[model samples]
Target: MPNLELLRIVDSIARDKNISRDQIYTDIEQAVASALRKHFNTEDTTEFTVAIDRQTGDISATRNGQAVPLTLLGRIAAQTAKQVLIQLLRQDERGSIYEEFKDRVGTIVTGTVARFDGPIMFVTVGRAECIMPRSEQIPGEEHQVGQRIQALVREVRDTPGGVRIILSRSHPDMVRRLFEREVPEVGEHTIELKALAREPGHRTKIAVSSIDSKVDAVGACVGVRGSRIKNIVDELGGEKIDIVRWNESSQIFISNALKPAEVAEVSLCFELGRATVVVAEDQLSLAIGKRGQNVRLAAKLTGWDIDILTPAEFKAGVDRLDQTLKSVPGVTQEMCDKIVALGLINVFDIEEVGAEPLVEEVGMDADLARRVVERCTEEAKVVAAEQEAKKAAQALAAAEAASAPPQRDARDEAVLAALGLTPGRDPLEKLAQAAGDDAGAEPAGNDETAKLPDPRQAVPGGAPETTVHKEQPVSSADTELSPEEQAVSLPDSGRKAGAAVEHTEETNADTAALAEGRAEPPASPGR
Candidate 1:
């Protein structure tokens, strides 16, 4: 019965591992037979072969056509069978994990958090554990043990430890997969995902187009009442997603990429992949987003160097350049207009070309061209210096902003008031100041915080009330005390009261000795 039970276990392992039951049984037989032959030191003429009965699960081994002794299957044979089975199961499991997950990379998968190895999390997807490294995790998403999660299958690494299933929540493609998951048309290939740019956990811009002319790609991705995309947003912990229809024309595509903002015009230099997009002054804020996020995403999505300029700013730049060129002698309005027409729109451009190129392109007088170039060069230096100053100012402002102390909110101010603390004042500062003024204070050069001997604690009998004022006179009663009694510490009576106490010569001498100590100055050598 026990031996038959082993057969059932082998079948279970085969199903779990997706391994052949016959192969596993054969491996067990050979390992046992090998161990037995080695233990018995079989003769040179003998050769071993092992078999497992298909139906009965009984094992048999022969040496040169003679049956080997059953005693050959001892402790050694059991250990060998265990080693072989473990090795086979591990290898099979690795193969299954690798095969099942390798092709699934770049796709989303659901898993459960199984464990944590420092910053890396082990998420169990089916029978395999996937690795979610800290680098690939969403910024603020905290995972806990046994929590169900969904992440993109980023990579599958076959390692000596095992098959590594690496997953990611922060990959740009993960958002693409999420869209495909929620939008049926995307999954079905009716809607093609043309481009995507993402700052994970912040925002994503995706361009989608439909193969069928009748289908609205953006509308489909958005769904009716945004129901389809809402599922994805919830799954992403509310990360913002922008889906727009893709356009073949670069101008139209760029305008669509910078959404939620109205664009006045888009001029493209396809050679440099540059797009100059003009927006109304009011729409400029929306076009730039917070910290240029909208423009940055637009640039990434369209594969262009996007420059967002308000209409007024563009006009101002053009007018300023025209006026600067006219200010230079030998550079006439006609000359400036010709330069603008040639796309040499700024003084720096003219200065960089020098007089030779200017003569070749504009056919101006050689002497005049040289003067204009020299003047432009001087003006360019001033502009460069101004720009450098502006940049330095901006850098200083940014540094200040980063290092500035946070302004306290109303609640925080109220709490501080209730605690009797002023803004910018440490709560314990007054207490420390008062402590410094006390007799137990640390020594300083001044009387306050100075370490003076306290006679009250050192004396046998209670001391008489006395004043600590330096200007106060000692009384006649002080001079009557013995050298031993001088050590008694007196309580500080008010300076005003001690000022009335009369001092005799002997009393002053005794008070001096008491406060200063009895040690005499080193006896001077006989002079």
Candidate 2:
């Protein structure tokens, strides 16, 4: 009897595994032949033929030109057939996946996070589970299981285990794909993406040009009020994107690449493949960006090494080149200007270019060109040495400043000592203790007058004993008295008797203390 059920099973498998029906039928025939060989215990060299009908899926087998029935195969033979069929089906599925994804390399695809194996994430993309390794994942981005994510198909390989599909979130093409998706003009071929540079998770700069003059490439990519770019940024976890209009001119292109910073001038050195960009002093930081990221990405996008400088620096370089060239014998001022005009800005640039350009471009004699190069070479070494020395001096000064001990004011130390606070001791605790002592001290009088203590008297063996009077408050009547009368009413009789003598003695004591490196006065005992 024709087994239409067998054909139905094959079709179902073909649909589920994305394998061709013909391939599945071929696998089944091979499996049946293996089963017959196992059932008959035939030698390895013996051949068994099997065929399956594409319409009805009836199995036919022959051995030694005789018909054989698959039903006669025992349980062991059936198990062998089942194992062989499963292996062949898995191989076919793997091949199908490899073929489908291999062509998709560099294209974007969406998938669900299936699971994680250490730093490797397995995402279910279509019927295949692709892997996104840690290196390919965007920095600071984490994916949860079952979360939908989009990535670039970086690679596809057929291995012994199965098809290995590699996905990348950090690839620069991911941004290109995003633009194509969000901007209709880009996808429709009206706008074209020229170049892109990205520091994944931080920022990206893309250069775009429009085929049609009426449509603005940058404006379209940015959409109305940045509605288009906002989508790409949101998809990249809020990464900043800069869409600049592309230009065929390298100078104009580089200026656009470093947008948000106005360029004062751009000098190109073709031989060195370097672009020296000059911005106003105020715009230097903007041109350089945080940690030179702006200029770095600009270089990558423009395919030229970039050196950002201020107006003053640019002038200095031009002047230095002019001076160095004029210093060389047989080199005239006009030749110097011509050399500077050629974008040879400094002695180093002249030295790097050697004498050929000076001869051919500047119309200088070959021997004179050699002499000019030698002069520039020697000048370059001197300039380099001077710069290195200047850098060393700056570094040394910085190190000294960082390593120097903080200067302590003598007045502050005296105040702290008077307050009974010392280094490495808690100031609050010391102040509390002093407060407690003050609270314990008995009041001298209802109205007390305070006097400044003499350092000479406070010294161990410096001057004769002088009476120290407690401070007393002056009465209202005393305030009305003249200065002479107030002096007469002063309580310190010693100050009136020998004021000059006390001043001389205090001065001597201060001089002695200062000479002994003890300029800070000791705390008075009558706190």
Instruction: Say which candidate scores most in TM-score.
Output: 2
Q: Which ten residues in a row have the lowest lDDT in candidate 2?
A: 444-453
Q: Write the per-residue lDDT of candidate 1 for residues 1-527, one digit (tens) a residue.
A: 23697689889988988778877886677667657665676634248777777777777778778887656567876776678667877887798789888899888999999999999999999998788999999888887898999999999999999998889999998888888888999999999999999888889999999999999998999999999999998888888999977999988998999999989988764433567788998999999999999999999999998888877766765676687767767677777777665545456767766787668767788988887887778877987898899999999999999998777788877877887668656557855765667957654444533343476555667554453544544564666656665565233434454343543555788778867988465567994
Model 1 per-residue lDDT at 391: 100
Alpha-carbon TM-score of each model against the true structure: 0.66, 0.78
Per residue, candidate 2 scores C-alpha lDDT tens digits across 1-527 of 78989988988999899999999999988888888888888855358888787887788888877888777999999999899999999999899999999999999999999999999999999899999999999999988999999999999999888899999999999999999999999999899999999999999999999999999998999999999999999999989998888999989999999999999888888877989999998999999999999999999999999999888888988888788877777888889888877878889998899988888888999899999989889989999999999999999999999998666678867877887689546567888888999999976643444544676557676565555564444674546767887776645534453665687799899999988998976689996
Off by over 4 Å in 2: 44-46, 403-527
Which portions of model 1 show Cα errors greater than 4 Å? 1-6, 41-46, 319-380, 390-527
lDDT of each: 0.79, 0.88
Against the true structure, candidate 2 reaches a TM-score of 0.78
